[model samples]
Target: MWQQSQAGWQTDTGAGSVMQHRLRGLSGKLLWLTMAFVMLAEVLIFVPSVASMRLRWLEDRLNTAAAAGVVIDGLQPAELPRAVQDDTLMATGTKAIALRKDGTSRLLAADHMPPQVDAKYDLSDVPAFQSIGDALYTLLFGGDRMLRVYGPIGDSDMIIELVMEEKGLRQAMLAYAQSVFSVSLMISLITASLIYIAINRMMIRPMRRLTHSMQVFAENPEDPARILPPAPGNDEIALAGRHLALMQEQLQKTLKQQRNLADLGLAVSKINHDMRNILASAQLMSDRLVDVDDPMVKGFAPKLVRTIDRAVGYTSEVLAYGQASEAEPKRRRFRLAELCQEVRDILAIAPDSGIDFVDSVAADIEVDADSEQLFRVVHNICRNAVQALANHRLDDPGALRRITLSAQRIGSVVAIAIDDTGPGLAPKARENLFTAFRGSARSGGIGLGLAIARELVLAHGGTIALVEKPGPGTLFRIEIPDRPVALGDWRVRA
Candidate 1:
């Protein structure tokens, strides 16, 4: 007997290993689709196995009846001749019989049928046939016993049939199918578990360690805390960890350098205060030199006076630089062209150093700025250019030592460009050009001139930048907003 239960076809309700593996790593939709495909495959294999079992049962019944000397008449089975009856019964195993003319059935020997055979196996209404003048027939049907073979006998007009049950074949197929499904499910669970554990250990744990290290470093940069564990082999993760360690070390070095600069600034601030007072006294003494009458005194006295004036100005700037505080700009309208010429005259590199300072400023150009602060900005940039040219001229006396200062109106702003014939800034210097002491040329004294120049220009709501030229030398540009000013309003008090 076959037992039917809905439980055999029930879907899995609990999340099994496959489902858990997918939840941890694979996409949910793909996992579900794969499971559905697995179930469909199982059904396809099981259904075919069941159908084949039933087909084999039918074949067995037909072969048995032929061997037992039974005769078939349409859908009925009949007794065989006594000569072949024993052999036929042994081969067929079961039998049924039916009348040929009217297609009716009568049981010739009930003992010949398989046990548990039901009415579902009956085939009395099927067509009849004649074989070897025997008026034979055979009807084949499938039910719980899986197959029925029926026919009629020729001589006695008796009917016969043979039945073969599929229960054993069905049970065997079901057991094999269950074994296959269990093995597949177990493999999926094991694979998923291994993948989950491997990912958590190798990837997730390392990432967590890196994150923790970064958090600790952010709180205290100087703390010697390890963020990355050293891997034994050379891999991408190991390379990244080494790089991170190097960056941390470099950052610590930079911080120490900055601290040293701060301490130097503090010591210089005190010395600068005292130096300013000494320069003030020198300025007063130089004022007395202007009154000397000798030709030698007259010739060199003015130079001495100018030198002292520049020293006093430099002292004031040094004190300001060390204090790290900016004085508010005393902004007023001024003729930009006049300031350019003043810087050119002060540098005085013409006949002496073979360096030419040329100005190309338009007559009507005016700008809003603090006269003294703007003067410092222009003076520092121009002095640097002059010094660079002088250094280059010393190397090659025939080299053109030219410094060109030009100013022009650009929309609502004025742009001033000072170009010099000197070796252009090195690649390393150019990169850190504006970062306090970081961008200084190795040959120059600390590189504060350009730095202070940029600071003073920025204080006036203007901008200064280093421009690269195709050939040799450097070009520095300063841009300031253009504002209209009355001619008299542009005067500076002595």
Candidate 2:
């Protein structure tokens, strides 16, 4: 997971570096995109601008030709001189100018007018799209074409027509286009620069800092110093920083726990070897004590033997616990009531400890489980309750100090609950109730009892939990289900 994160960060980092990577990086890409959109907006304005310019140019020529034709029309039958006519046509920038009144066409001026114009336009009511298209066509390919333009003479009945070469108009349009492009290019650069700077400061820089922090944190997650300090703000960047900090804290704690477990496993490995030898020797000595005929010794010898046997088994389990593995339960059908009695015996709470052990399991109730593992699970919880009650009774002598063990067969599962009436679990212990080392509230206690108990219960494909119950003390429920019966066995039983 961290490798993928680092790779992604590196890719983004590379994108910020050189020209090749710049286009791929967030900052550079946004810069280019800003420029592109601004330029595109300018293009939209440019189209209408050039079209409007073209319309104005044609309107001016029409007005000039109409004024000249009106003056010449009043001089009926008196023709103007050829040189004057040619000068009038030149002034209007046209090859010919004519006036039409009541279907009668009259030539007002002529200067080598074309036999037929290449294109004709009735500009009095041209559509917007057609006018734009015509303007663009003139700019692109109008240099060599001849145009005949006709329009009404300002609400008058007469219409004025002019034949003109498009080359001059094309030249004007090209110059105007050049000016527009220069200004548009400048505006686009300015706009794009502003947008790029704003986005870079607001988003890109923060993201880069986040990625860099992640890379550093991933390198040594166990180091609490490497955790990110959450950035201040309500924005996503700040939120992400806060979450990352939280995640780092949790990961650091988990890593620390794992490291402690590893060291513990190693320590146990060395200690158990010698510890086993000592316990084995004690076991042999206790076995010989059974032969003593003293009444008290006879009664206590069996209990001592059972205690040593349990201790030996516990040592092996502790060694296994350190290695983060355990033997699978050696499951068998057994009476659960008998197992509860055994846990009570193993704890052997003093009668005057001000603690009472209540066994509420029915004698007939049976469970399918590893007897020894189930014993550990119950004994560990019952023992903790005994300790808690023993301590609580000293502070509050009148307080009810009791641990209750209850079991029942519910369908194919057996539910066992251990409730105590001393004091409930501390807030911190409850939070890490089944977590080794951190779960212990008592000083000098490494909380492996509940952790190991939970592990053993889960090994039987069961669930164990600290349940909320009214009144004082802690209540733990363990549910172990019966293994699935084989089809062949069921058929035989049927």
Candidate 3:
């Protein structure tokens, strides 16, 4: 009972809004539309009815006048009394009645001279719209003014005319309009109620359910219970609910994965803090191996030292790069060719390494970039190419093993292409090409080099992409442009 009362109040509140605010809710809009359409329909029906009412009223007057004319014409002239004439005029509801017979005007009844006809209507052959328009005109503006109506009387060679007042026609029209309005009001209420109920059940309720689900989901998205339950139909609302549920499920799963990655990063930070000191101590011990005298120890000492140095460098880089974001670069101009030489020299290519390093940049070409970040970007690519070339292990005499670094300055941008003549990347590595810990091509590589290189390159507002050719090697293209020149102190220039 309370729910029913609340619904009634809601309906009344929606309906009782001022005209300016009436069309607010779903129910209110439906009600207004229904009333408008029903009233329009009633108006359509009322005009013709008023027009028809006038037509019938005029016909009855003409018929009564004709009947009176027949009765008076049948009587002798001496027997026609003034009282009978007055009675006939009153019965016909006209000031006068006349019959035109054989080209002669014969008055059946007339108590006085009929007033001048304000309007004339020929009932026998009038167009429909004109008749309707004239009827409306009389109802709106015609007071007690007189009207003349004429029509053929049966098969005789005579026409009947009646002069009557417009008041009766107007009054009848008002009554007819009142009747139509009452019925239209009832129909509007019933139709709007049915349509409002049907549409609310079909659409509004479902939309409300989805809206509530989204609000709850937004408050605490990780709670699985907040997801919307799928509705049970093949309609658009049901489909939308299902798609929303699936999106919430996928988002929850992604949030879980992100939380796990954050926890792992915290754990790795703790381990790296202690591991750095231990690796430092190991490095000191490994340096002492230089003074050992054993032959096997001398043979393996260099390789072991290099491996530990690489391990220490890897740890420091991984920890620094694991920061929330890479630090912004300090920009400066530097020699590109000189930087490439430093990277190649650091790799320390042996005479029998079977890999050729070709640097083709111009000696004087310079780039505006961060020295440390650009060095890492170039070094990582060159080192990866060197390692890839060494991995080929060409025992056959004629196999080509080459890593080439070439560059060109194109207008405002410098385009550098790194080409290698070694084995290309596998499909999985190409798919996750620049992603961290995923684009690994070598065993035990951690896959952070290219990812970090891409990150640093992006920080300089440049792009790095791989270009593939028909040969065995993979090509990486890097383009870095100079920063925009800032306009300073226009007053001084002026």
Candidate 4:
């Protein structure tokens, strides 16, 4: 059942070995370990029991011999009948019986006594370990030899000595040992079986269920039905199951969202070619309107052209979503005030509309960035601000409806702040602020504006974030860093 190794006997664990494979499993291991420990406890008890049995057997012989010796010593050696002496010796299982009193040894009975004794025992004060060792020695390697056994008769100075055959004692011990082995084997098997059943029910079975659930979930993670149900309890296994269930639920929702987005992209792609051609035709017609001399026609023609151009750009951005990442920013020097003013012009807040566009940036302040991409970044945010302000209802009629743009230079980075007097972002919007399709600050918004804005800003090696303040308005901060100059170019410019 076990093989020897450098670390002592080990159960075979090689994969090719059937026994090793069986023992390698948790159930097999638990069963065997239970049995091994139970047997170990049995063996420990068995040793002392055998030793005690040996001691008790010898004491019984001494007791019987002592009683017979007392009677034999009282009568003259010739007066004791030879048949009676033989019967007493046979009953006590001794060849000869003697008594020692006052340093004088008296032979009470004799029947062909052996010339020499092979071993001796003084049962008065033997150490427990020594007794056990002697018992084990006799059980393993004893031979047919004579044993001289002597000890004090109970409560008397008279000591009884008996010369006995070791073969009889060995045989009795062997019989007792056999009985103990059988009993121990049964007890260990029963105990180990009980414990194994309890553990298998309590721990192993639940673990197997957990592993099976995980395997089934892994095979089809997107399937809602494959998610593990919450197990009841506060145990580690239950906690793990709860967590796995939660994770699977989240993965399912994410996969659903991804599928929806994929479908949207496909639909957009199919209509994209026709949409671009229609926008191009509209652009051509709007360009022709630029030549009209009528004041009303001339005033609206430029705005119409710009609007159509922006619409074409919007269509392209939608089609390109989720295809490839944004291109690297082409950095160049531009005035911050001009960019902010352009965003205001594109928005074209009507005079009748209850909204104010405040460009607070000074004309002298400059920024190093990609002008076209930076315009998209600023325009998208401002446009979202416009929509938010237009939709929000102010509790106070006198509350200002204003969208402000401000900028400052700090080291090699330009910081731009956009503030709007509107209802602050909703809780859900703040949570997924830069996430596409989820960060809508207002109702009926796809939240792609800020997502695209964040992309463009990041491409310029800058950062964009919603700034929290204690007020009923939204604030955004955009910081764009200047591109690093080469050492040679720096020296040349200097």
Candidate 5:
């Protein structure tokens, strides 16, 4: 049983060995991916932005020089102020050129001038007089390397060309890029760490709690209730946690109920052995009732005898249902509708109760089941529904007292649904509906009807569930597998 319970977990975890052994959960991978994407985007945007800003600053400085009466021809090496000359000489040292108003140009600062610049200068004829204006020409040559800014001095015949080296601007941009890259990397690392921690706390932790609780429950089913904590909000994960917790609570309650039922079954097995003898004696006495001439005795004797017989049969069935362990299903292909009718007839519901039994199974449909055991399963459910209706009628006399049994074949499964128009099971009862004594409420009868029904269905490799009913009615559904089985294969081997 433990192996069977652990199989699903093993299958899920086995597929991702790395995930299982290294990273605790998928959140770690997600955090890393998020951080990587953020860092990449920051690098892409920040590098270009810093470069553009530096180029704009250099252009502003050149315009300032031009505005201060720096002309191409008159602005000779000696005529320039020491501060301006020194700054310009140092600034343009990497890639500077001095252009004269006579269309003459000299390389004052560059170690090497690119071929495109000399060719373009000759082609455009180096404008004799250029106006210094607010509008600056911004151009990029060969993949954002070279930025050229050209303008004229106010009312001057000389065009002042200050060739600023891109290498320095490139270096400044590189330094800024490095700083941005470092900061972005740090931010990404921090963000990823925070995301990993937050996700683990908010999502993974609760899931682990749920998984651990389930493992514990599976190991020792008799252990006390251990429920997962409620999620903090109404998000989908929180809702899933809530639902999982509810399901665990229900399962825990069910296991407890089954434990109680096992105990009850043990006790009932002993009592049943003794009760059968007493019932046998009573059957002999009942046989003698036919000889009694009193009309009152005649009318009531059969019912009393039948009731006692049914009680004896019910006791025997309880023992069989509880004690059997993995016995082969005593399956036989039989008409389901006929079996339902048989169960209704055997219950012998009272006329004054005004209870009605309606069967809706198709006539031609058949199912494979252990006739005796399957009969007990159906009889118990139908009897319970009838009893519920009878109980309701005692209170609200006008209430509809009907129990409807419907069966249909859906795919390879045959479903039988029993609905009763009674005050549906109480919330507490519903919570532990199929749990042995746990299903009982204020009005109770050992709470074994549904439990026994479920066990019997499971014995035949089938399922029994409580269907959701809207109001004032209980709906129970039993689904049996439709596969045909040989009688020899189904019978008890011993």
Candidate 6:
């Protein structure tokens, strides 16, 4: 059941990943947006074009009627034969035509009694927006009612008016609108295609290539062939691709180094197991050597036992790596000053050794920690400081060598500081400080001291860092936070 549930969860996660990639794609979205903008521009032009066409159609009728009025009014009467009048009205597409000059109206020509004009429109002084609206109204709601239109004749006081059926005008408007729409449709397609092609060529294709390279690289990062080949341009897309390629190359190199370290760690674990056995037997032998009836053996026996014990501790720490986690600290309240004194005694600094281990931690201060593990932490650090001071003393015996330990509690955590007046750490050592097997300050050192110390500190919910300062010594700070108390449970008990 557990395996089946795990498989189902994996399948769901894979489907989510695929859907995310599809929704994040940019090419299809850009194409649709381009087409939409082009259609919007065409609609803007179409509205005004319809208004202008309607105005022109009305003006033609009025002008034709005015010209025929001149011919008729010069005759014996303002009238023509029925056939001629019918022909004139047919050409103008109006039932009657009239002219107003000097505030007097004259009927120019008529086929019969014209119907009452249902709507009045004066095109002389109207805004463009109003014209477009009126044109749309006629095209949509206009029926067979007569429409009265009047406008001035080119800077003259003579105004021409036409009484015309709206059905014919509405039909003509529908045809004109159809043609405009067809042309606008073609224009929108052409504009959208050009924009889409330009952007896809310059942006989308290059971005797609970069995305594909990233997907392939994520699947198998060790393959150098998966890196993106940057597109041929100086644009943003090209630059992004180039940067991605560089980052992937660096990442691959780092991953390869980590793999080598993994293999080395495995070998070290096996060797550490065998060495622990040898050291255990040696420790037992040293335990029995104190019984020998030799004076030197009696004196050196204790030192030999201490050395073997330290060796055992070192091997145990190394073998602990397979657990993938630090051992849980045995927490108990102990005096901080006493712990520092123990570290001092472990280093066995003599009066003439020129190195001083000052336990400046306040006697009143206490710490909740694993005493043995915490002792190992401070011992490793002070031992390294002693070694450095000893090396410096070989050249300059009078140089001051001091390792001072201090601590203070702030809020919920205690900060312990270790300062050494020996030569400061070199740049190379500082770069990888606290990294196992690589942070050694001196030659022939395995560099595990600081690393093991850091692991122990971290197990106590603490942090270790190199404190930068303007002085001729190195400083390391460790901050250990107290475990959170269950305030709610305490209140309930209270």
Clash totals, every prediction = 30, 0, 0, 0, 3, 0
Give the per-residue Cα lDDT of candidate 2 at 123: 76
- The candidates, ranked best first by TM-score, are 2, 4, 6, 3, 1, 5
Among the numbered candidates, top TM-score falls to 2
lDDT (Cα, tens digit) per residue for candidate 2, span 1-494: 99999999998877656656645799888988899999999999999999999999999999999999999999988999999998998899999999999999999888886877899988799889999999999998789999999999998899999999999899999999999999999999999989988988888888888888899989988888899888889998889889989999999988888888888888888998899999999999999999999999998898899889988987777666656578989999999998888788878788877788899999999899999889988988888888877666345567677889998888999999999986788898989889888898354579988898999999999999999998878899999999999999999999
Highest-scoring model, lDDT: 2
lDDT of 6 by residue, 58-127 (tens): 8777777777765665684545678887888898988887878778888766866664778878878878
CA lDDT, candidate 4, residue 370: 84
Alpha-carbon error at 88 in model 3, in Å?
A: 5.7
Q: Which segments of candidate 1 are over 4 A away from where they belong?
A: 1-174, 189-330, 341-356, 359-364, 393-395, 441-452, 455-463, 468-471, 483-494
Worst 10 residues of 3 by lDDT: 18-27
Cα RMSD, each candidate? 13.5, 5.9, 7.6, 7.7, 12.9, 8.8
Better of 1 and 2 by lDDT: 2
Residue 483, model 1, lDDT:
53
Which stretches of candidate 3 lie above 4 Å from their native place? 1-24, 67-96, 110-134, 137-148, 154-157, 165-167, 186-210, 223-325, 328-368, 379-451, 471-473, 481-494
TM for every model, in the order presented, reads 0.53, 0.90, 0.63, 0.86, 0.50, 0.74
Return the clash pairs for model 2, or none.
none
Which parts of model 5 are misplaced by more than 4 Å? 1-27, 57-72, 75-91, 94-96, 100-158, 162-169, 190-221, 229-241, 277-444, 447-494
Q: What digit string (tens of lDDT, one per residue) describes model 1 on residues 1-494?
A: 12234443333434366556556653443344455666666655645444444345544554455433333333244444554444444455544422323355444333344555543332333222222111111112222443455544434544455544544434544565577678657655555456556665666556555666777778888766643445554766656667777887778777776787788788887888888899899889888877888788887677678767877776666746645656778888789887777677677776987878878888798878887778778888888777777666356667777888888887878888989878878898898887676777447567677777778888877899988788688888999875555677677531
Point out the higher-scoring one by TM-score: 2 or 3.
Answer: 2
